[model samples]
Target: MAPTPDEQSRTRTLEGVLWMLGSGLSFVAVNGIVRHLGTELPAAQGAFIRFAFGVLFLLPMLVQLLRRGLPAGTLGLFGLRGAVHTAAVICWFYAMARIPVAEVTAIGYLNPVLVTLGAALFFGERLAFRRIAAILVALVGALIVLRPGLRDLAPGHLAQLGAAAFFAGSYLFARRLSDLAGAGAIVGMLSLSVTIGLLPFALLVWVPVGPVPLAWLALVAAFATLGHYCMTRAFASAPLAVTQPVTFLQLVWATLLGALVFSEGVDPFVLLGGAVIIGAISFITWRESVLRRQRSSAVIQNG
Candidate 1:
């Protein structure tokens, strides 16, 4: 007999977890390559090349976007999102260049926290006491990583923080796009638009990139694209609550890679901070999922 729905759901959740794992590792590889190349090229130019190559993967969807175009307000939103995302990418490269890879990854855990805060602030969602506490705990974790008074603040840390903020903005636009268009259209427009937006900045600071760094940038594009594809697959297969927790492993992989490959010291504070932030975010995801299910069940019973 075929598996029951429960069994199928379990199977899908397992697959999604695996996909998330792959996505995390792939992104780790992409970050490593970006840092490696940052030494040789301008951050903006390198980011442009990476996204320019990333656009090649989205070409299959271009015809559809061109034929239908986007809804009236969405193109403007996409433009705004693209510009914000470009800034985020530039900051990311700059951060990766100056900071340890592990530190950059740890700081990046702030994105979801900022996203949740953004929803509360902009959408008039309730900022419940529990979530507020969670945010505070995560902030404490950030302090552990930064140790502001103990050490002088590095520009790289600030840059990564900025990237996290802008990335949250991009994600907000992504959520809006999901309601307005399909995934292909959303990704295609963002990729193509960001590539175009970066072109001018790249031209202004463009330095001749040899074949080696160009190839590395191509690898960066491939790994990041694949990581995103895996992330989408993971979500398609399972609930966000099911797959989101798996991302915590990324901090582990990034830390180890930084130590082994780059000879960077593993900071205890960063690890503890990343874990705390991941724990808070995971709780928020689980709590939201439970509330959503409860609402659905209530509606069904009332109907």
Candidate 2:
């Protein structure tokens, strides 16, 4: 017998969760490797190399896209995304080199909330009261993590914040592009565009990197690409609400990895703040999902 609709939804959600888990692990590996690289390489050069390798890894897809050509109106969006994402990556690399992995990861949780707000502002999605509240709550969580009065906020913290905001912009662009292009095309274009965008900055900060670091960067490119692919699969498999909460595990993993591997002390404030931010993000996602279902039900009933 065929499975019920509810059962099918459950299966899809489970699959999404699993895919998100894989994405998180892939990112964890990427972060761990970047953390290990430390301040040995300039952030711009490091980001450029990673994305350059990303382009290499995506060569087949790029060639395929070149042969077929891109969809109309996608090139501009891809360029815009690349610009924002290049800034995000440089900031992230700088922060990763200077800060603890867990702190960087925790601070990055603000992206989803920012994305939600961006959707409302740019995509014309309704900004409900709950979303506004969630945004405020998430901001409070960010303050808790930073505790500006208690400790001097470092440049790394500021860089991570910029990275999160820039990343949110990049995500918004990707969401728009998703409607116009296939996943492979989107990913391939991103790698190519970011590599081009980063080229000038990398040239300005040119530094000789040994073969070992180059190899490690190639691995970073592979894992980061895999993470993006898995994340796309997860979104395709189920609603955002189903996969959003799973990201909380990334913080947990980052914390453990930081403590165990990097010998970084666990900061309770970061953990607490990360939890709070994740909770707000989860609430926003859940609310959106609920409203979406309600809208669908209303449409069906009216029909």
> Top TM-score: which candidate number?
1
Question: Clash totals for all models, in order?
Answer: 0, 0
lDDT of each: 0.90, 0.93
- Cα lDDT over the full model 1: 0.90
How would you encode candidate 1's per-residue C-alpha lDDT over 63-144 as one tens digit per residue? 7788887777788889999999999999999999889888899899999999999988877789888889888888888888
| Local accuracy of candidate 2 as per-residue lDDT tens digits, 1-303 | 999999999999999999999999999999999999999999999999999998888798799899999999888899999999999999999999999999999999999889988998999988878889999999999998999999998999999999999999999999999899998898888889999999999999999899999999999999988898899899999898889989989988999999999999999999999999999999988887898899999999999
Taking all chains together, the TM-score of candidate 1 against the true structure is 0.97
TM-score for each model: 0.97, 0.94
